[model samples]
Target: MTCPRCDAATIAFSIPAALRAHLPDDRPGAALCTHCLTVTPLDDPPDDTPSFERVSDAFPANDEAAVAFACVLALLDSLVLYRAELDAVATYAETHGADVLRALERLDADDGVDAHFDVARRTRQLEQFI
Candidate 1:
């Protein structure tokens, strides 16, 4: 699903059972934006939505830094879904120079083979944005 705020692809995250009770009855779940880190309520949950994934529940939902970290991880986990945000990330990296790429390198190093491949593929795609 696309993020309502940034038009970037979103990751489907099931709301924790503990938190579900607190949301309006009509809200089925939530989606996290790969780029802007916006958490949007979903009226109809997606079929592939994960059930309380670690990254979704690892940190408090209100923590901005944690959410951004989670979103980055999620983005790398499935770059195909988060592909649209790569341009935004690449743009920021260009503006900031090597530091941003260094941070991404750190993240890529910690991830699995798929993430490495995705990063490599997306790095090539970033050239178009540049």
Candidate 2:
């Protein structure tokens, strides 16, 4: 990972924090852009950093995104299938929202996913309804 501040290659690392469920709020997925001193993630980066840590805004691995997606699926005023799809994502996150978000933050920051959001494959049925 390249730190926009120092323009250095960084890697994924973790910190000690509380896990409400399986995820830790203080130790969100992050990378060091400036000599391992600057760590940030897709969800919320440090206040000082100006440039984007993640390549894309839509983090597929982001639990927040997943939560958001699930919420969208649940809240979208669409057909039954749309509700079902969002409900599925919401359900999946409801149980493991924390840990999944942690993992997702790592993937999103690392650019491990090819596309922005992979829900297209998972929520294909939504197309027909929309």
Candidate 3:
């Protein structure tokens, strides 16, 4: 995997058995990029780097995007499956569709780009209602 911070190639580091046992998914350990001194858990992406060390802003903040998606989800919770509700969903899809597509494109283009907010998955969730 590439380093999320510097976009450098990453080297895997060995983790003690004690730490590996505690980690979920039977994951091995963490990786480190000597160039940037970034240490990320084996499962976590390099884009999970500290905000201060972030290399780019092409991807939306996960927290902010999650909140936005949650709000849309909340709105969905109360929506009745009717034409008006469907229209509202359609309007939302129309408004955000392009942005979502572009984000997905960026994600596809770069492994360093993190989906911190799981934007693609959440967008799909919203789209299903449309």
Candidate 4:
């Protein structure tokens, strides 16, 4: 599956073992991290959803389906919060980074000047990469 993040296509599939404990014993499946260990599936696959779809065969990224899902994820954050997330994304964008997902992790830091400092340094580091 195309990692819904950086779009680096890969066939690696399966959820992390830590989370598999929560999965139903009936089905044989896994949802491993294609990126970082940040976000969660939030729910099982829809009833009719197929196991895999070829990205190469799908519409271009400009299509409504792709943009809508992505935009919705982005709009879930405040502008400030969004930037903080982006700063994290920008950090990972350089080397082995998972930009979109990790960007939000910075928001989890304790509130105060220390948080701002961490954000700033990370922002600069991300900027260098971009």
| TM-score, per-candidate, Cα-based | 0.35, 0.23, 0.27, 0.22
Off by over 4 Å in 1: 23-26, 47-130
Predictions in order: lDDT: 0.45, 0.38, 0.40, 0.30
Q: How would you encode candidate 2's per-residue C-alpha lDDT over 1-130 as one tens digit per residue? A: 5765566665444321222122223344455342323334434434342222343333234444333332332233343534554444444544544233333344435443332244344345443433
C-alpha RMSD for every candidate:
11.9, 12.4, 13.6, 14.6
TM-score, ranked from best to worst: 1, 3, 2, 4
- Give one digit per residue, the lDDT tens place, for model 3 in 11-87: 55433343343333234445544344344557543333333114233334553332122123223323343335434
On TM-score, the candidate that comes out on top is: 1
100: Cα error in model 3, Å: 45
Q: Give the per-residue lDDT of model 4 (tens digit) for 2-50.
A: 4344444323222323323332332323222222211224234333322
Could you tell me the lDDT of residue 89 within candidate 3? Answer: 31
Q: Which regions in candidate 2 have their CA more than 4 angstroms from the true location?
A: 15-27, 34-36, 42-130
| Candidate 1 C-alpha lDDT tens digits along 1-130 | 8877668766675443433443333255667655444566777666553432232333322433333333333344445555565444434333433333444444444422123235545444544443
Winner on TM-score between 1 and 3 is 1
Comparing 1 and 4 on lDDT, the stronger one? 1
Q: What's the C-alpha lDDT at position 49 in model 1?
A: 38
How do all the candidates rank in terms of lDDT, highest first? 1, 3, 2, 4
Instruction: State the lDDT at 70 in candidate 1.
Output: 34
